[model samples]
Every structure is written in C-alpha cells, then in structure tokens.
Target: MRGLLTVCSAVLVTVLTVAGPVPAAKAAEPGGGDIGEALRHVPGLTVVDEAPAPDGYRFFRLTFTQPADHRDPDAGTFEQRFTLLHKDFSAPTVAYTSGYNVSAAPNRSEPTRIVGGNQLSMEYRYFTPSRPRQENWADQLTIWQAAADEHRAVQAFRALYPGKWLATGGSKGGMTATYFRRFFPHDVDGTIPYVAPNDVIDEIDSYNRFLSRVGDDPGCRTALKAIQRDTLKRRDEFGGLATADAAKKGYTFTTVGSLDKSLEIAVIDAYFAFWQYQKQSDCATVPKAGAPAAEVYAWFEKVESLTTYADQALAPYVPYYYQAAVQLGSPEAYDGYLRDLLRYPGADVPESFVPKSIERPPFDHFAMPDIDFWVRTQGRRLLFVYGSNDPWGAEPFRLGPGSRDSYRYFVPGGNHGANVAQLPPDEAAAATATIRRWAGLPPAGPEVTARSAPAGFPDFDADPIMTARPRL
Candidate 1:
C-alpha cells in the first residue's frame, strides 16, 4: 500500500489530495500488443492487409475494434463513419498522440465506445519501454517514448491503404501528426496535427513561467492568492477535485512531487528566470537589487529567444518520467532530480540561467518537425481547437511560428480536450467537412467552419467565418 501510494503520488503531485476512497480499479484489458487492432477503418473503405512487399518497405493492415466500440443515440459507435479505424495509411492517418507528459508505460491513450454487441471500453494502452518498472507505476511513461511501440500500428495502417491522406492526432498526438507530415510528407497526402504543442520545450518552461507570473506579478499574484483563498475558504463549494473526487476514486493526482503550496511556491523562485526568458521579459516586473535592472533585463531577453516551445512543454514532464526519483523519492530528492534536469547537454544556458526548453536535450529521435514547421514545410491544412477557460490555453500562440497558429481556430470557453468534444453538433460536423475536404474526400455537407476566432482577451484577431483557403 505504501509503495502503491508512492507510485501514484509521483505520477500526479496533487494525487494525494485526490486519492479518493473508492472501489478498486480493475486490471487493464489484454491485447495482442498490437495497437493496429484498435484503429478501425470505415466499414465501406476498401481495406487490405500485410501482403508480401519489398524487404525494406513497410506495409499497413486494416484492423477492427470489439472492445473500444460503444453505442449511443446521438452517434452509434459503429453507426457513423468517423474514421475511427486502425488503418495503416498508404497515405497518412491521424497520429492521435498524447501531450508532453510521462507516458512511459502502463498507459491507455485510446478511448473505447460501447457499441453494437461489442465489449466495453477499448484503449491504446502503453507499456514501459524501460525495465525494472513498478506495478501501477506512473513515472517514465512519455508520449515520445510511445514511438518505440508505434511502428506496428503505423505499418498496419499503411498496409490497409497505401495512398490515403492522413489525420494523425491531438495534443501529443498532434506532435506525432506534425512530425510524420514534416518528416515523411510523401508517405501520406497531408496531416492535421491539431492542438499538439510542436514547441514542446517551450510549453513546459513557458507553463512554469506562466505559473510564476501567476504568483510573481502583482496582478497575477493577486489572482492566485485570491483563488487560493477563495478555494480554501469555500473548499467544499469548489468541488475540491484533488481532495474529494481524485482521493475518493484513487484515480491518481495524489502525489505532491516534492511540493506542497509552499514548496511549489519556492520552486517558482527559479522558475521566474525561465519565464522571463520565454515571455521575452514580459513577465518581468521591477527587479530586485541582487541583479541590476539592465543586467536582469538583458539576461532575460537572451533566455527568451531560446525559451522556444520544446523547452517549456517538456521540462516539467521530465521529472515524472523518472518514476523512482519522483513518485518514491523524498521531496528533497525529487527536487534535486528536477534540478539535474535543468543541466541537459548542449544546454546553452548560463549557470545562473535555466534552459527555457525541457531540462533534457531535444529528442527529435523520430526526426519530426513541430506544428508550424510542418505547416510551412508541407503547406498542410489544419483545424486548431482549444478552450478559453483551460489554464493550459492561456498562452496564445505567438513569438515563433505560433503567432500564426491563429490561422486555425481559437474557441471560447474551451479547455484542453473540451474544445473539440464540446463543439455544437452542427459546428463540429462543419469542422469535419473542412477535414474531409483537406483529406481529398467529397464534402458531405456545407463546409464546416474550417477556422474560427472566438471573442476573447486577444480579442478575435480576424473574422472567424472564413472558409479555409486551398493550399496557396
């Protein structure tokens, strides 16, 4: 029990608070260790499987899902054709990746719908690429590492149809989508990476900065303090996701990962440097006396340029990747592990400066390009979706190729996964129209709203009703 708590805690710093008292979780479903069986192809789409081919060439196969399917009145699991098949793309298929997190192993990325005479939920479960892993361990699991296991799935899809267009993933999946298209454009017709953070390095470091600003800047600090106080005071009213539900269900999120409010607050001390670098000193307020104003300002600007996407997104996700060091390690020990990550190789930052990207060296192991890099490189069509209320959605795309992310969609009140899932039926259907058109399929209805600019802080940069332009 102690070891179990330790593992869950490492996976989610606040999991301890949410570790709810509930029914025990069942063991994960079994599989052939072939993810290809999960991605089901459209019923009518002519499918194929691995046939004798060139020795060095990969072939895709068509597969089916018996568990991941479910029935619904609005949308039957197998009733409609939403391209939820396991097809190797003669052209490319959606990568459906996860985000920058510890996805090392014992993970489930796919969602199953209970459909016609089918088993319960089906998922794309993950395994630890490393050995000596823990039972119910949450560390060392990363979406990037999932690459080691994706070959069969990709090959299977490719063999199913050799020359189909592609639509890979969302968030982490988006990264894969962008990568596949950028690096292997000829493999698939094009890609739709979705909301994947291409600048993974920037996402993590930038988030740390964002959090620091929430604590450091007077206005942001005021907001944080106010939120903390309010949540604490009402406590019960806010639903206390961590303490109540997570704790009750034992769903993980209980671990504090070498931090409580106090420790997290302290960690934010160093995080300021990262933020200043990523935000280009926008996060800077009046400097303290230890560093001169000019020196501090100059130092920050240098950091900002390198505080690219990869730095921010991946840095925070690294510590958790080392499960033993995080879930089971002492708070002080975990804190040090985090510190060690800041010193990755080719890390160009000054001793006093932390690299704004991930604490690890950039691992383009797959040799894939990021979001915008693919857009510019392959001239791909995309449909970006995100929520306004999502804390992760706060950072509007900009600075690098992201400023142009506005070219996609900026949804209002959308948070993380909520953006796409929450779309009104008509609206979502329209977006699908845009995708089909991009995929070279005949449009089934009025073109879906390909790009939208909802009203918000940056305040609708341009009109949202415009149709997507054919590759210009």
Candidate 2:
C-alpha cells in the first residue's frame, strides 16, 4: 500500500513559438494486428514494460485506469497494475486475481501453465503501484470494489483474447476469484480458487474449531499448544530476543502495539500457522515442554517470523488487514487456552491489528453473505481446491442444491498450499480434465503435461513467499 508518481510538464519559449504547434500523438486503437499493438490501444490501459518469458510466450507489465468507486466515475481514478503472459490470441486466458500486490515482476500461474493459456496477473487495488493517491482507504477498498476493478481490466482485454477464459488465485486471491465471479459471472468461463476461505463474519468460529483438532497426531497438537504456553509463560525472554532482532533489523512494532505484545500475538498464532504450513510428520520437530528456552524460541521463530508484526512487515499488508476488518472477516483468535498466560489479552485479535491511523468501519455483515449466497445458488463452472488440515478450509464454500457445473476437492493431508495438482492421481486427473473442459479444450490423457511456473511465480499459499520477499 505505498508509492508511485505520475508527472507532466510543458515548455514554451519565444523562439520555439515560430513553429506550428503539433497535436499530441493519438493513442493506439485496438485493431486487427499484433497483441502488443492492440494492447497499447486499449483505452485507459498502458503497457509499462515487456519482459522475457518462456518460449512461445510474451510478457508485458501493464496498468489500467480504474475508478476509486465503481459506482461513481466522478469518485476519481487510479492506475491498477497487472502483468500479461501471452502465448497466442487463440489460446485460452487465465485472469489471475492477486489478493494483494503481485510479484515485482511478471510470472505464470499454475493454472496458466496447466491451461497453456495467456495469463493476466492483476495486483489488487490499494496495493503499491495500484494504490490510489486519495487517502480514503476505508471507502475505496472493498471486496466488491476490487471485483469491479478485475471485471473492468478483464473486459478491457477481452477483445484481444476471444477464446475461453478462466479466473484463478490462491488463498486470499482465491477469495478474490470467487468474489469476482459473484460480481461478474460472465467475465470468466470458470474459476479455480485454491485454499480460499469463505469467512462471512469478522470472527468465524470455524477457524478456532478447526485449529483445535486439525491434524491426526494429538501429540503434535499437544506439543504446539505447549510451545504456545511456554512462549507466553516466558514472553519476556522470547520478547527480549525478538526485541533485539527488531532493533538490529530496524523493525518497528507500533502497528501492533510493542514488541512484547507482538511476541504474545505470535505465540497465539503459532498453532494456526504450524498446522497451516507444516505436515503432521513435521510435528516431531516441535520442541516438547521443558526444552531449553533457546530451543523453544528457535522453533517458535521458525514457525512464525519474529518480524511478522513489525511495522515494516505489516505496512504493506495494511490494506489486507483493513479488508479483513471491514468486509472479508478473518479468523478469530484461538487464545482461550492461553488466556491465563496472556499479557495483552484482547490486543491479539485480528481487528486489533488494523492500522491505528484509520477509523475501523463497522463490518458489513451482508457483503460476504451475499457473495456466499451467490456462490451456492447461482455460481457455475466453479472449482475449489482446499487443504483438509488448513484452518482456512474449516468452512469451505458449499455448493447449494441449485448450483450446477461446480465442484470442490480437498487434498488428503494437504496444507494451505493445496491445489488441483496436489490432489490424488484420479482427483488430479478429474480436476485437470474439468479445467480443460471448462476452457473449451480437450480432455486430458493419462498424463497431462503442465508447464512449470515461471521463476517469479508465487506459491501464494506459502508464508516464506512473504517473509523472503514482502510485496510492495
């Protein structure tokens, strides 16, 4: 949620006035020609840079003008940035809706590779380059508004790619795909939302319920809770270490109060994070009770970054937190067990993390319910992939009796990183075949070759994707 600047200037002199004024070059118009040329002509769209791509493909970074409020063009406009991975005009297209700022560079999504189609990876509004200059974050940022941005961007490019289209994303992005379909069903032929949650309220109970008994190994769960309790019991020690690291790294903790509170927050989040990313077998690595203080802290640090709540880390995700607070509700804190050990009792809740600078708007209870209703009753050609153990998957989207041509698959023992590719052999084949059929392509054979994702492609469900390289 940061920076970008647009500039313009005029120069005039007595001597230069002798020549007749020249009209500004007319913008390109979409016509029968190369995709690049056609893209340059798309109204309100600008091609920022073209980068290297795999063979048979072309890549270009783009920005599109979008209204701050889709309901009112007079509300002003901002540039929403996105990247296009082009193969052939005739090939299908995957409109990849990033729930946050996209990668710094262009990359292919798994669906793009699987469908062998062009990819349009769009950064969500209020995220860096796509962030609006206006300071009205609360009113401008909503699931519906973000969906409108996607709708316009996709339609803007639809002329060039008349072939079938699919919308896909992971985690929050998966939620975006679902929301986009809810808002504009005709915009894409199908949607594949990976590990997406349908949190219809600010504090969904399913999250805590799921985290309480997620994995098969009760020992692992016990160990994780012990770790939480140990960390909170010795918050000062772990907080001191985290504080030192933050000071050395210039990480600020004002967003979530102080390093002390953040440490407690991390401890509370440890259980959810552990199950979200770690496998049941990995539980043995969790330091059991009575382990050395250093051992506990090290493992805690491994499960969740010490700087996770730092200002530097949280600033980029303020918009996300805001969205969660007001519209897309996040999981409620599962701190009932640690209530006794808690130093900052209620400060660890998700709503508590919204940037202190802005006034938190009341949660729009109807927004998510509306989308959920649409998904269940009217949604078609929707494919959902979720991890059985993922806390976010606790309340997976359920198709209604009236819904048609929609499917949901849960990967056995999968974490948040679940996807169609991760399903069992038969399930994977069925998912792939469904995707192909939706995209108007042929059914898959025994072995369907999916292209490797580009180096810049993100593992949207993974935490390291952020810890290693926080998006702007």
Of the candidates shown, which would achieve the greatest TM-score relative to the real structure?
2
Residues 287-307 of candidate 1 have per-residue lDDT tens digits of: 333443344334322422111
Please, what is the TM-score per model?
0.39, 0.89
lDDT of 2 by residue, 1-472 (tens): 0011001001111212232112222333332357777776677888988887667777898888888876565668888888888888878999986587766454666677677788888889987878777767767788767877887777777777888999998888899999888777788999999888887555446888788788898888888888788777777777778878898989987778788877778777778888787787888899877788778778866777756788887877778778777877777778998899887887765566677778877877667766676677678999999989888898888898757899999989998777777788888888898899989998866345343354455443443333231211
Please identify model 2 stretches exceeding 4 Å from their true place. 1-33, 202-204, 449-472
The 10 consecutive residues of candidate 1 with the worst lDDT sum are 112-121
Q: What is the C-alpha lDDT of each candidate?
A: 0.31, 0.75
Candidate 1, lDDT over the whole model: 0.31
